[model samples]
Target chain A: EPEVTQTPSHQVTQMGQEVILRCVPISNHLYFYWYRQILGQKVEFLVSFYNNEISEKSEIFDDQFSVERPDGSNFTLKIRSTKLEDSAMYFCASSEARGAGEKLFFGSGTQLSVL
Target chain B: AQTVTQSQPEMSVQEAETVTLSCTYDTSESNYYLFWYKQPPSRQMILVIRQEAYKQQNATENRFSVNFQKAAKSFSLKISDSQLGDTAMYFCAFMVNYQLIWGAGTKLIIKP
Candidate 1:
């Protein structure tokens, strides 16, 4: 089965530093999303991308966060300046389309630790 | 906005026994999708089962099944003859308006 793949399985960055998390969604998927989970917390949606633009974003996806489909197969999330609270597991997911019952395939996730 | 709730924070069942995890959601949309995902120690998200709100019949995958009550806004997962590998954290989620909303999650332990 085809699955979403993410690069940099684990990353450690200092406060005020920048970090980029990359994902390669399933080839045929049309919708891509970024979600984060703080330790012992719920999985929170950060942003959703479709048609080369952001479709929707949550409050957690603030000014410092940006997502790009930089290439045909690469989707990336960049944080301008990482904060200590930004430490968490970032997951990339993709769905075939906007169908009513479509399911998302998620990557193993990148563990970001900010010091 | 849609919200998913998994009331049970933690639960445990003996191997070979049955276990049920409860989930509820608040949504006004007539058409949506519900899903149950499992995260083991590896922290990789795995789809367990899914149900379309428009369908009345429950969805089942082998030993895993769901009881989806659209009227009550309830969706529960049942694991039959559980095995040690079934131990993991389970999350109930809903898809609405092209967005995914997830619950806090329920930690399940299958004791040998």
Candidate 2:
């Protein structure tokens, strides 16, 4: 089965540094998303991208965060300034459609550690 | 506002036995989607099963089945003949208004 792929399974960076996480969604998927799970916390949606722009974003997705599908296949999330609280497993997901019950395929996740 | 809740934080079951994971949600939308996702130690989110709120019948996929009580606002997963591989963190999610609300998750341990 086709799967979403993410680069740099793990990343370690100092607070106040910039970090970018990359994901390659399934080729045919139209909707892409980014979710983060803090240690021992529920997964939280950061943003959803469609047609090269953001369709929706959560309150947690503030000014310091940005997402870009630079290419037809590559979706990236950039954190302008990392904080210790930003340490979490960031997962990239993609779905084939936009309607209700659209099942998503998720990547193994990028573990971001801020020191 | 909508929310998904999994009351049990941990559960254990013997291999080849059966187990059930409970999930409840608060939603006012008449048409929505409910789903169960499994996350192993690898941290990969795996789609386990899905149930549409309008459907009266339960959804099943092989050994994985869901008892969805829309009026009761409850959805539970029943794993039959559970295997060691079934051990994972299970999350119940409610899909509404273009957002997916997730539960804290229940950690299932399959004893061998």
Question: What is the TM-score of each candidate's chain B when compared with the real chain B?
Answer: 0.98, 0.98
- Write down the lDDT of every candidate, Cα atoms only: 0.93, 0.95
lDDT of 2 at B54: 94
Evaluated against the true structure, the overall lDDT of model 2 is 0.95
Q: Distance from true position, residue B94, model 1, in Å?
A: 0.6
TM-score of each: 0.94, 0.98
Tens-place lDDT digits, model 2, residues A1-115: 9999998999999999999999999999999999999998889999999999999999999999999999889999999999999999999999999978999999999999999
Worst window of 10 by summed lDDT in candidate 2 chain B: B92-101
Instruction: Pick out the ten consecutive residues of candidate 1 chain B with the lowest summed lDDT.
Output: B93-102
Task: Give the DockQ (2 decimals) of all models.
Answer: 0.69, 0.87
Model 2 agreement with the true structure over B1-112: per-residue lDDT tens digits: 6889999999999999999999999998999999999999988899999999999999999999999988899999999999999999999998887778999999999999
CAPRI tier for the interface of model 1: medium
